[model samples]
Target chain A: MDQQKLFVQIALHSWNTQIARAEKVFNSYSESEFYKQIAPGKNRIIYLYGHLAVYHDLLKETLGLDTGKYSVLSPLFLQNPDNQESEMPPVKELKAIWNEVHCDLKELFNNVAPEDWFKRHNAMTDADFEKDPSRNRLSVVLNRANHVAYHLGQVVLVKPENI
Target chain B: MDQQKLFVQIALHSWNTQIARAEKVFNSYSESEFYKQIAPGKNRIIYLYGHLAVYHDLLKETLGLDTGKYSVLSPLFLQNPDNQESEMPPVKELKAIWNEVHCDLKELFNNVAPEDWFKRHNAMTDADFEKDPSRNRLSVVLNRANHVAYHLGQVVLVKPENI
Candidate 1:
């Protein structure tokens, strides 16, 4: 395979690996420990979980992907500090939400026509078509994935030894 | 503080957070998990640990920063299968290397003369810098940070369950 194809494959594999890794981590966590911060003033696993789902929702909108009938939460769910104090769904319920979002994203990726992967959409960035479009999609997808990975690190760090 | 100063502070904070997060995850891992791939045919935690250090080494060279005395590895460490087996370091050694490189990066950030931050280096891309030095620096710094975050995410994703 050529360099571009190699990169795309690597990216897809990276995404798949992360999705499974996250499921494993979240599934293993107890409710109390999942919400605990790894360090003082650091983000907890719940925040990262919410943030990942919210980012996928934004990406769907940005890419104009049809996530039919799925009730993806708004980015505001992760914003607005006052709303953060509100009770979160039980661990199982949150996992279901995460799974649903991932399912939609997987579907979207499956349907992305290779020729259209580089197609520019005005909703995401102001850059013109003359600029490379693949770079844009790559940036968004990679950025979101990285965001999840960063938080997963946080979760692993803070998790109690006994639990 | 002006916008430039604000950006510098943000960049510094991001670098600090990433290193701390990496250290947290690094310390939690067992020896076996460090080299174990969380998923079949996927990256090991040790791969990420080494990759991050190597990437910093590359970026330092790119920006004309000191890379110390070690011979820098080629960028294609991922592609060459032969190199992969022979060059892979033990988890403990990789973590120590990451910590050392992380410190070097922190020191580099601390000593960056504000004027040097604004200085334009010839980028591989066609983006024009003569129009605004501040904008150029912002783009460069943001892009570099994203690069680091991307690899750091890989580290988190590959963490073993027991670790």
Candidate 2:
């Protein structure tokens, strides 16, 4: 296995591990617990899920894949910092969006050609690529994986029903 | 640049960003805030720091770097789940250990040769290397960065002053 192939495997594995960890936390939530904050004035389950759903919207374009199924979420959940008060869709609606968005992403992942993984992202210019040749699909995947793991740790800390 | 050099730069940059982001959260703490939880039944600030400190102790060996310190923290903070009450050092003692550990690590990072970045980590063999070429000093650094980012999100949510 060459380094590029191995790097893609590691990055994808990391992304899968990170997403599974976060899903476990979200799966454990009960109805009431979904809206409860990790700490006072901190983000709740609904907000975090919606935020991630919105942010993953960028991953499509960033990875040279396709997107655009969740723009309605952009206004309500995207711009505000976590825990900021805002009008929100019902939990069921956000869950639907989250599922739809991730399904599209996974489908895109399956269709990407092997050589596409090494291609520069859409925004990379010739000069920028020269300076940081690591700016490719592998870097994008690794970065998003790290981003997911960071937020996963917090999502797990929501106030427990018994606490 | 060749893929090897690009990989090293990406790994080091990721590690540095993760460390800095975590440090920014810790540096914002006051004396009392360091002991507070993200929320009820979640990790306290000091405990998370102690936990990361203990875990990073393994990085020296994992990356083929040297280590001579920080075993004292292993029992108190390592292996234990967060929020479990236990004996603890004073904040100053843990902070001292954290500083010493990182100083040693930074020195180790500086001393690692360019070729060393692609070298297999301790215990990795010919067969394993062929199967997972990404398993090297660079992967260790990148994995540790993701780990730190996970904990940093929790460390940042320590109960706010006003809310």
Best by DockQ: 2
Kindly list the per-residue Cα lDDT of model 1 for residues B1-163, writing each as its tens digit. Answer: 3434433553444445556676787677778777665334455666666666676655565555675433444443333322336556566666676677777767876788755665555454335544533333324444455455555554555542312
After superposition, the stretches of candidate 1 with alpha carbons farther than 4 Å from their true spots are A1-6, A67-72, A81-84, A125-127, A132-134, A160-163, B1-147, B150-163
Clashing pairs in 2: none
DockQ of 2: 0.48
Alpha-carbon lDDT, every model: 0.56, 0.74
lDDT of 2 by residue, A37-77 (tens): 76677777788888888878767876668756677667766
Question: Could you give candidate 2's per-residue lDDT for residues B43-154 as a string of tens digits?
Answer: 7788888888877876797776876467666776776666556867888887887777777888788788766887788858878986777677777777788899888877
Question: TM for chain B in all models?
Answer: 0.74, 0.87
Interface RMSD of each: 13.7, 3.6
Total backbone collisions, model 2: 0
True contacts kept of each: 0.10, 0.57
DockQ of all predictions against the true structure, Cα-based: 0.08, 0.48
Candidate 1, position A18, lDDT: 59
Model 2 regions more than 4 Å off: A82-87, A113-115, A122-126, A159-163, B82-87, B113-135, B159-163
